[model samples]
Target: MLNEHAKLLALFKQTGEIIGRKKLQKMVYIAKKMNLPFNEKYQLHMFGPYSEELSLRVEEVCQLQFVSEVKEKKGGYQQYRYELSEKGEDFLSMMSFHFPDATGMLEDMNHKSSKFLELVSTVLYFEELPKKEVAEKVFKLKAKQNYSEADLDEAYAYINRLHQVAPKKGAYS
Candidate 1:
């Protein structure tokens, strides 16, 4: 029943801790974009791609004591930090599941800033659109972000690097 949840747990197991709700969302979205085993549905929100299902799943894991959520006040807003709990480690140890080898991918993303990941995920979201069109859409939709052409170029490069390293179409036991 916790097959998907276990995958999320394994993500935490690999990356020490994720420090923002948006970061967590973007990381998973980017993984899904790379054709990883994530099954969440996402829509473009104010922060780029957002997923309510993933949010609820994270909440469920927190409620089950398999993960921990810590709320911190960040000036006018709040930020959340997530990590796998001891119980979570125990649960994962007992579950038998296999996912692609995404360790390097996850580590690379885990070290990135949410703003960068936001741009990367946004670019991936509009990937089907022409390059210029994607640029226009990003500038229009995320005007407040102040992303420049150079940033877009960097995001594309990052996406390409990720693609080069993405796991082949197969499951890992």
Candidate 2:
């Protein structure tokens, strides 16, 4: 069994790096993306660390917009999903400042950019919203215009700065 911290890290990544409880429950336990496999995929429900507990922690810590429920199929049940609002991204970046690992920390910063965009893509895919509609929704939720486009550039710049500061391998030869 995966530990709670490992489960959190994996689930956060699996939910397109931003997702809701129902999907998280379904995917986390058996996500092939995370290299976990199980028989009877749909039947594998309730990936432990429980729904209510995870939801509270996610809401308190994750700096993402809490979107409405998602219906998997037409006339099917609705499950909640989250899209990272701009403020949410800001919130995540702020939290990253405290990451304790020094070695390869630059890689983590670089990963954050891709993760943010991936989260946006997840929102578009699950919500069935067109590109423009999703963009508009993100703008409204984050209370900022041009966030998706502009923030990518900002994230890249930070990543580059970190790379410059990281010690170069084999440079002393």
Candidate 3:
């Protein structure tokens, strides 16, 4: 099994772009829900589903110069964006063979907006709900986000498609 840092590095490599902390958290949570062996514990937090383990791993990688963190001013507040450093990229390339499914999952998530990822991850977090009930349940759970039934449907569809293609291999399968 790959370590959390390796999984995060693979994410950066697959995306090939800078990612915000919240987006990175959601992406990893989604991958976990899909049974990609991320092994991070997720809980509902300020943004939706959050993984503190992943956050710490990101910090470690930054400290190791495996990833670069840039502080950017957005709307008068500072936002940290992360991208894999050259060393991180080299490490990810070396470790890629051990995590083919994880790499594929990250590739699937590439180009998705944070909002979309948040909605989908939130929906998947409540996976016990019946298919027909998912939209209603997500609508209620994310009331502050004002997600409509249509939005729920779209997010559910995306999650469902991902599962169909990826087909998680463990207990969730």
Candidate 4:
């Protein structure tokens, strides 16, 4: 089985671009919420669900030359983007043999916008919200997404199922 670091490299490989750190974090968090076998533990943070372990793994991958980090000034603020290095691609290729489903999962997630991931992840983080209240809270938190009640309902149904099946403790740690 691929370890969490290897799984992250596979995600970078699947994305095939320099993904923003926040996007990466949210993607992993969503994957975990979806019961995709990621082992990271997440808690609500300023930007929504955040994981220190994921951040540490990113740094580790950078140090290992499996991934490269680039800093860019976007909207006059510095942001980091991560991409798979040649070594990382090679590692991902090897890992694919052991975990074929990972590519498909990453591909599905890569198609979602960061904002959408954030919306779903935030809702999942607060799964206890009453069914009727979910849309209100989600709209308040992510008004820019323009999500409808129907959207929140669908997401809630899906995430709720995954949350029920997902391991209670860290799966990867």
Candidate 5:
């Protein structure tokens, strides 16, 4: 359980500061799908794959001062920015954590808009199905997003690029 927390800490260690709770969630979910070792349980939610376990772990880490969560106003609603506290860095240094070199993949993800990540993760959530089926599901479930074949194609191609970038622990990379 706390081991998972350590991994989250490692993510901050790698990515510096990650903005938005939703981005963090999608980043972890995407990394897990890429065959990295995250064990958060997710359900399909309004945005995409949401992990309550991941959420609680983040909260606990914040309470423990391992991570910092700051709320900021983005347009109409509130947004959260997460970063590794000094305590988090200290704790992570003590753990013998072996993880993929996801720095490139994570930085790539961090550069993307949350909406694009949303579409990417939603595509990944139903990845077990055929491409046609996944596209159909995205069309059905994410009609509000106004995704086109171009978007779906971009998402699929982006998945390949992400897999290649994660490094080691190969499934499809």
Candidate 6:
């Protein structure tokens, strides 16, 4: 079982993935997908181990420059919402950090520069081709060799990992 702090961090990480959306219910749903237990209605003022602590953490995030807050009331319940600010979005964009296997892809590309460049050209031709397509093309190329599926997986994984860190290109802007 995971601790609440870990769960909260997971929630923050998941929430960060959902850019431009400001609905607690949606955030809760995303949290659920991430296997985090989240209460639907949150009371920020009340101090307690669960809801209150969560509220404080949320509030602290909102107090930061990169976060924005919105409030909504429905059926006797108050909901506070948070989204990334432009500055936050810009900060996220400035970060070109890659996920776990990104380095491996860099090395592979370095070793097979022509092949990788060809695949990259294919990727660019589609003009908004999904990461899946890029992975597939690369996989087809790798099939001629004895490479593991790890490279293709890494490509998609890196895309998703980037998504987790920030919004897609032009989404936050």
Clashes of each: 0, 2, 0, 1, 0, 0
Residue 70, model 1: lDDT of 96
Cα distance off (Å), candidate 6, residue 39: 19
Cα lDDT tens digits, model 5, 1-173, are 46888988987877889999888999999988877789899999999999999999999999999999999998999999999999988898888767666787888888888888899999999988999999889989988989899988998999999877665665322
Local error of candidate 4 at 105, Å? 4.6
Candidate 5 contains a number of clashing pairs equal to 0
Better of 3 and 5 by TM-score: 5
Candidates in order, TM-scores: namely 0.95, 0.30, 0.85, 0.73, 0.93, 0.29
- Where does candidate 1 clash, by residue pair? none
Candidate that would win on TM-score:
1
Q: Which ten residues in a row have the lowest lDDT in candidate 2?
A: 38-47
Q: What is the lDDT of residue 125 in candidate 3?
A: 78
30 in model 3: Cα distance from truth in Å?
0.8
For residues 1-173, write the lDDT of model 4, one tens digit per residue.
44778877766766666457778888888777665667888887767799998899889999988998988898978888788899987877777443324555556656666766777788877778776676677777767668887777767665665556555544333
Question: What are the Cα lDDT values of the candidates?
Answer: 0.92, 0.38, 0.77, 0.73, 0.87, 0.40
- Residues 30-92 of candidate 6 have per-residue lDDT tens digits of 233222344434321211112344556555556655567766785697655455566555554
| Highest lDDT model number | 1
Query: Looking at candidate 3, what is the lDDT of residue 142?
Result: 72
Candidate 2 lDDT over 36-62, as tens digits, reads: 321112321122222355555455444
Residue-level lDDT tens digits of model 3 in 1-173 = 34667877866777666557777888878877777657878888867899877788888999989999998889978888888899987777777355544556576686688888988988887788786687776666777888877887888789878887764477432
Prediction RMSDs, each to the true structure: 1.5, 15.4, 2.9, 4.5, 2.3, 17.8
Cα-based lDDT at residue 22, candidate 3:
79
Q: Model 5: how far is 63 from its true place, Å?
A: 1.1
